[model samples]
Target: MLKIDTVFYNKLLKNFKINIKYAKIKTIHKVIIGRKGKK
Candidate 1:
């Protein structure tokens, strides 16, 4: 089951990276919106 464990770990790591990237994008969008609203 060591192979399965590695596969699962890789998937989890990938998902974590995707989540962080999505969060960064969302924050960037929010910052832009906020700046626009300030005008």
Candidate 2:
């Protein structure tokens, strides 16, 4: 049904957003570590 599909779509979108956020954080953390290593 349309409602069920929307629910699923919303959940997928939310998960995708969370993943992007986590990825960004990971990259930032790596950059910080790299900088510390250089020092």
Candidate 3:
């Protein structure tokens, strides 16, 4: 049971990390596209 819980926790952490990385990349993409119309 403990091992199962550990595996689940690790998977959750990995997914969280991936989401953060994706968000950062998306923000950078938006900046490059000049979404806000800034000069």
Using TM-score as the measure, the top candidate is 2
Per-residue C-alpha lDDT of model 3 across residues 1-39, encoded as one tens digit per residue? 999999999999999999999999999999988966785
Query: Model 2: how far is 33 from its true place, Å?
Result: 0.3
Which 10-residue span in candidate 2 carries the lowest summed lDDT? 1-10
Which is superior by lDDT, 2 or 3?
A: 2
Residue 17 C-alpha lDDT in model 3: 100
Tens-place lDDT per residue, model 2, 1-39, is 999999999999999999999999999999999999999
* Candidate 2: regions farther than 4 A off: none
Query: Ten-residue segment with the worst summed lDDT in candidate 1?
Result: 30-39
Rank by TM-score (best first): 2, 1, 3
What are the lDDT figures for the candidates, one per model?
A: 1.00, 1.00, 0.95
Evaluated against the true structure, the overall lDDT of model 3 is 0.95
* Model 3 collision count: 0
Clash counts per candidate, in order, are 0, 0, 0
Alpha-carbon runs more than 4 Å astray in model 1:
none
